[model samples]
Target: LGFALTCQYLAARCAFGYGTDLRAAVFRHIQTLSQTELDKLGSSTLINRITNDVTASQSGVNMFIRLASRAPFLVVGAIVMALLIDWQLSLIFLIIAPIVGFLLYFVMHRTIPMYGANQKRLDRIARRTGENLDGVRVIRAFARQKQEDERFAEDCAELERSMLAAGRISAVLNPLTFLILNLGIVAVLWFGGGHVDTGRLSQGDLTAFANYMTQILLAMVQLANLIQILTKAQASSLRIAEVLETKSSMQDGTETPDTASEEAICFEHVTFGYPGAGDPALEDISFTLQKGQTLGLIGGTGSGKSTLAALITRSYDPTEGNVRVFGKDVRSYKGTALHRCIGTVPQKAVLFTGTIAENLRWADEHADEQTIREALETAQAAEFVDAMQYGLETHLVQGGRNLSGGQKQRLTIARALAGKPAMLILDDSMSALDYATDAALRKALAERQGMTTVVISQRATSLMHADLILVLEDGRCVGQGTHSELLETCEVYREIYEASAK
Candidate 1:
């Protein structure tokens, strides 16, 4: 009993320990994967790999630890005792063992590939479920809930079909074992009884032979359980290994930007597109901006304004040409160092589940409340934030679902402001605000004075005040000048200005 308890303790530790390590390994690999790699491996599939696949691997570890130290020992000991009783009867043990071994091998070999396909089907089901939950609002707004349900059901049915197919293959192992082992037992009895009558074997000896045969059967059963886990784990491990083996496309540079230049950003002949995307999102886009200069990007939808912003922040490398910062290539800065110098607010405002202070602190880990308050003021978010009873301590739900759109945008801007980044990119973030608030926010941002700023907006008023405005269309800059210069020289700018004037 004490020995059994010890085995259980070791098994638990081994399973949980290996599982914890595996989860960490997978997570770290995910962090190293490029944005393209991440898109290729969907969130649902990655989640499945880290959680369900790791858990399956844990089960394999548990079975190994529990049976490894005990089963072989018992089987060998039992067989040795049986041979002492009757060497002839022990030969029956050898003959049946090989047959059982062959069957177990066949089952394991056949089921491994099936298990791999099953895991992939599981990924599809998990992905569909995640999409359904995350996009529930959009689904309901479109009144496609029933269609989504059908889609989810289809993926789940596929998973179930794969599971059933693998289960059927696994099921054959036990029945085959029983049939062969039962035959071996009958042979042991037949021969042992004859020896007993011939006075070569005692009744006690014959009974011991039967017990040995039963012990061999039990060991084979345990081995079968272990093999089943191994086949499953083999599939999961291969999946995990695939992720680990994938090299990140974005390589980190060893050096920081040059120290002598105040010009914080420059893009030269930049053209870029997603892999397999037929057309370049931005083509031959060249621009330069110094410290304290505000460059406004004005373009219609699909005109590549946001894509240009992504390049400046080094979210991705330009397929052709250089994005430079401080007279050095943007690729020269390490990932964390590159982000440290840029504060960006996306079109959609995203906030985490935390108190207002905690969310702001993600920008500057040690920022004081005064810094936070100042940023909120600059964003024109302080009015509502201070009116709240908790103020900076106000709690937010996931995605800031508890806050209004304009409020979320303001908080997001404030969080970025608090970080005191060297450059700020507002990617159409002012769309949620009223004209009055938008003007106020822009004035406050301009008052910051020395920071380089790039504002991407469709609003003519937003770009009109910028020192330089670039009008984009069809992935190229058809116009690059001040708002007034563009209106005089560029027809596209004239149309946009005329439209917004009304």
Candidate 2:
């Protein structure tokens, strides 16, 4: 019993240790993967690869350790004991063992492919579950609850059918093995009884021989169970390997960027297309921003404005030319140096489930209350934040679901400001705010002239005050100049300005 406890402890230690390490590694690798890779591999599949696959592998390790010694010992020991009891009765072991081996081989081989198919279907079930949970509000708002329920039911039904099919195949292994072994036991009694009558085998020896045969049968059954576990583990391992085997399409540079120079950002003849895209997203895009100036990107939907910003951030390297920061290629900037210099507010305001202070700390871990308050004030978020019962300690629900859209946007901006980055990127983040609030936020940013700013928006008012503005249309910059200059020379800019004035 003590030995068994020790064995269990060691097995648990190894399984959990490997699982933790593998999970961390997978999470880190997923971070390295580009958005393109994320698009190709959906969120649910990746979640399964990280969580479920690791669990299966751990279970496999536990099963192996538990059965590795015990199963073989029982089988071999039983054969030896049977031989000692009666040499003639031991022949039944030799005759029956080969047939059991053949059965195990046939079932195990057929079960592997089934397990693989079931795992794939399980991924679909996970995907549907995730979608239902995340989009619950949207479904309710659209009055599609019944339809969504039916869709989810369909997903579940298909998964259940596949699992049942695989399970039914596995079910056959036990009854068939037990039947063969019981028949062998019956044969042993008849043959051993004859020996006993002839005075060649005693009744006691016959009984011992039958018991040994039962041990061998039980051991083989356990081994068959191990085969089932191994099949599932093999499927899970292959899925995990697919993720580990993928190389990140984006690579980081070794060089650290110098941020003291006058030129904060530059793009020269840059053009890029996403993988498998028919046309380039950005065609020969070129721009520059001085260290203390504001650059605005104004474009219609699908005008490639966001693509240009991604180039500066080095989210993807340009297929044609160079994107640089501080007189060096953007690709040459090391991660810390690049991210430290840039604070980006994405189009979507995503907030984790944590206290307001906790979420703010993501931008700068060491930021104090005074710094955080100042950022909130600048983003015009101080009023509502202080109004909360717990103030900065107020807990935010996932994605800031408790707050209005405008409030969430302000908090997102404050989070970015807390970092005090050299370059601040506000990517159409103020759309939810009122005009008065928007104006106030812009005024606050204008006061901070030392930090380079890039504002991308469709509203001309958002970019009218910018030091330099670029008008994008169909992936090309048709105009580039100050607002007044573009109004006079560029027809596209004049038309946009004219329309906005209405």
Which candidate has the highest TM-score of all?
1
- Candidate 1 vs. true structure, TM-score: 0.95
| Model 1 regions lying over 4 Å from their true place | 258-260
Compose the digit string of candidate 1's lDDT tens values, residues 1-502: 9999999999999899999999999999999787878878888888989998899989898989899889999899988998888888899888988888888888888889899998898888877777878788899999998898898888878878888888998998887888888899999899888988999988998888898889888888888888888999989988888888888889988776553478778889999998889999999989888778899998799999999998887778899999998678988888777787788999999999999999988879999878998999999999999899998899999999999999999999999999988889999998989999999999999999688889988789887888889999989999999988998999999898889778
Which residue window of length 10 is worst by lDDT in model 2? 111-120
TM per prediction: 0.95, 0.92
Show pairs that collide, candidate 1.
none
lDDT digits (tens) for residues 340-427 of candidate 2: 7888999989999999999988889999999999899999999999998999999999889999999999999999999998888888
Model 2 Cα shift for residue 167 (angstroms):
1.2
Candidate 2 clashes between residue pairs 3 or more apart in a chain or in different chains: none
In order, the Cα lDDT scores of the candidates are 0.88, 0.87
Question: Candidate 1: how large is its RMSD?
Answer: 1.9
